[model samples]
Target: MLTSYTIAVIGGTGPQGKGLGYRFARHGHTVVLGSRSAEKAVPVAEEVAARLTGVDGAGAVSGAANAEAVAQADVVLLAVPWDGHDELVGSLDLAGKTVISCVNPLAFDKRGAHGAVVDAGEGSAAEHAQQLAPEATVVGAFHNVSAVHLWGEYDYLDEDVLVVGDVVEAKQVAQDLAVAVTSRRGIDAGKLRLARVLEPLTAVLISVNRKYKVNSGLRISGLEGIER
Candidate 1:
């Protein structure tokens, strides 16, 4: 049975966030497209609603300010860039909510994109988020999925999401949401600390995508018939 959840994407006006909002809404979850500018968020939600017209719960999306969206959601996904991550997350009160972050700490240069060495003392961006929202159950996920593929019109999304968190149920909530989006598999990659491993791997995927001119993602093989 699929659990119906109300999800709020904090950076939902952006490509990654909009794509996720669309997917969740298509699957009957109430999706809130949150942004610093509520004005921008509205149109993004409207567009998602238009795309999801024939879906089972097409009208399940809306837009709002970041704080408002967080207030209404059963779960919150952070898709904001790393530059503004700390400030944006620090301003919110996410106590008692399932907060999922996919922010990869990376930087681009003339050469190519590379993972930024995290100096926050916490290891990764997800850990930084965990520190920002102490009362919230923070789970790291969606780090390696491509924004382009996420918003593409493919019949199904074929990829794997690595979900990591200290809390058992919180990780389950993150995994459930991952599966809710599409046929993609969400694997429990262990404790919150493992975010250190998953975050930088995104940079490697980016490098590969650029080199091959493909929107590639992650897939851990050798595990056959793994139960979700």
Candidate 2:
């Protein structure tokens, strides 16, 4: 039998990861919050259940270490940071899975701005991840969403998520997950190669938010009518 469309948030104990985990659970999909340490993920999973207690059709969420969680999960969200990206990618068996990458490669010091030192030559973090996990259909998403904003009580009444990937079906799965979290619509920003643009844009947004001391997000006004 085919597995249920359960979602797994690898490294999902953190802000962005937990946010997606909570969203997925609230939408009634079983969510496994995967972490480097399963013990650490347990508290985070409990927090997701507490935060989303009142949502309709909500289901239970659990925790596990990364490898174990991904093995049984249908949709996998890669939420580990740039520093651990390579190591995390190397640990997975992603054949035929839909892997959504929510990472941005940034190198910044306390005093200044440093750009990403990319490994893919193409400079897109998502591309690098996809190259490492060739059998998985990798898609770029949630790059621009601030972790703080994501974990907080933002209604996200309507927002825009830039979804990028080479495979159409993979991108659609990523978009479906995005919509479950918000009334926001996800716009397919074309092949994962375009993630070169999206990833750096995240750094720019970080710089802006750091200077402004408020949540900063990119939202496009005209996308709601297109209906993808």
Pick the TM-score winner.
1
lDDT of 1 by residue, 103-186 (tens): 888888998887888865348889999999999999999888888987888755777788999998999887887775546557
Clashing pairs in 1: none
Prediction 2 TM-score vs. true? 0.91
Q: TM-score per candidate, in order?
A: 0.95, 0.91
Model 2, span 4-81: residue lDDT tens: 368889879888898877766766778999998889988888888888777877878988988888987888888888
* Model 1 misplaced stretches (Cα beyond 4 Å): 120-122
RMSD of each: 1.5, 2.7
lDDT per model vs. reference: 0.86, 0.80
